[model samples]
Target: VLFPGVSIDECEAFTLAFRQLSLSGLADCQVVGVGAVRGEVVGIGGRRDVEQTFAETTRPDVVLVPGGIGVDRTAHDEALLSWLRHVEPSCQWMAASSTGTVVVAAAGLLADRPAATHWLAGAKLAEFGSAASPERIVEVGHVVTCHGRISAMDVALLMILRLTNRQIAEQVRIDLERAHEQAAVARPSWWKRAVALVRPAPRGPVRPRNEQLDTSDWVEMELTAEPSSTTPNGDF
Candidate 1:
């Protein structure tokens, strides 16, 4: 875990849930955070506290990044990026959720690689030199990226499979009551489907809201500002 102080929620969720699963004998691994603080603090407990006191270390077997709105803070942080660059060599497996790929991309780690991210931030990944796709989960080389919250279960299952084997993945899936909903469709000619793993859905607009104007629509705010054109008297 690369715990950026800015990514408290993502780090906390991934760490706690991962520890629980690991402790339950789902997987054999240990969780460590890089760039954490020194002692404990309340409110932001466990992983948050761990990350707060995280000491920098070389990469391990796998590195995972969880998804949250906080990814923007991690993606642009230079110190965190520097750490990732330094540890890239020792790391073998890498994973990220949601816009967390933004940080991976910003680190220049996704060049010429396929990655997954929230649809809203896919274009941003492209701008950072990654070939972003609508896939719910994408894995290219040692890097894995997924739509985080929306595809957490799928990503976790996939990681379990890769880390252990299909037997573990199947058993965990049964425990979690998740059926593998993955399928392969013909890739579009124009779009390279190298690592695209989309969560196909019925094509159409979903959950159309027949919203009439609500009372809140009548509320508006007026702002006091200078006029578009300056008055000759400077007071009009």
Candidate 2:
């Protein structure tokens, strides 16, 4: 994994997303940093998962780069560029999240390739010899790219689905959806909800399958938020 000053969201997303693969027992592999120290990675508030893992002589089958201000800085790094160019031939797959595309594109690997990147980087793709994609995730053979940090979640889940099956991805969707629900509040989608004869939900990813607070749980959660906001209709 490329973690050259990656966004904390990107890094943590990559890390927490492993719960599904690990839970489903699909990814029979581990994570390692290309140029990271063993104890502390100095990016995105810092991560401890990517330690001195280059102990074996084996090369990674896949490489994923997450984006941030660090990626912008690394885009001009001759050392990183040279390494990417050298390793690409031996890699079975490669991908980037958000501005990490800038770094990968800097290595010349994306030349003439169709890929998606952080929207802010749309103008920069032409500079790197790659085509911009209309989709959030784009794949041309073994090389893939995701548009942004949140979409990076899709990248990881999609990889799990490809390497394993749909069941695992569904399970991951459940976990991720639950996490997001716990983290924020959102608006409902009245149109889609009306189609199903259900109430609208939020603007983000759909709630996990088989999930929705029961009447009692809903009331409890509602009271926890703002006791006075709770009404007979459960409107808040």
User: Best candidate per lDDT, number?
Assistant: 2
The digit string of per-residue lDDT tens for model 1 on 56-154 reads: 466466677665455566677787677667667677667787677888888898886768777788777877888677766677877778765535445
lDDT of 2 by residue, 1-236 (tens): 54556665675555455554565464555556555334555566555345543433145666777777655567887766766776678776677877888788888888887678877787677788886787777877777787764566666655555554455555666666675676655554677658656544455556433211111232123223422332222100
Q: Which candidate is the best by TM-score?
A: 2
- Model 1 clashes, total count: 6
Candidate 2 local Cα displacement, residue 174, angstroms: 3.0
In candidate 1, stretches whose alpha carbon ends up further than 4 angstroms from where it belongs are 2-17, 36-47, 51-55, 70-72, 177-236
Per-candidate TM vs. native? 0.60, 0.65
Please give the RMSD to the true structure for each candidate, in Å. Answer: 22.7, 16.0
Can you list the residue pairs that collide in candidate 2?
188-201
Worst 10 residues of 2 by lDDT: 211-220
lDDT score at residue 110, model 2, on the 0-100 scale:
86
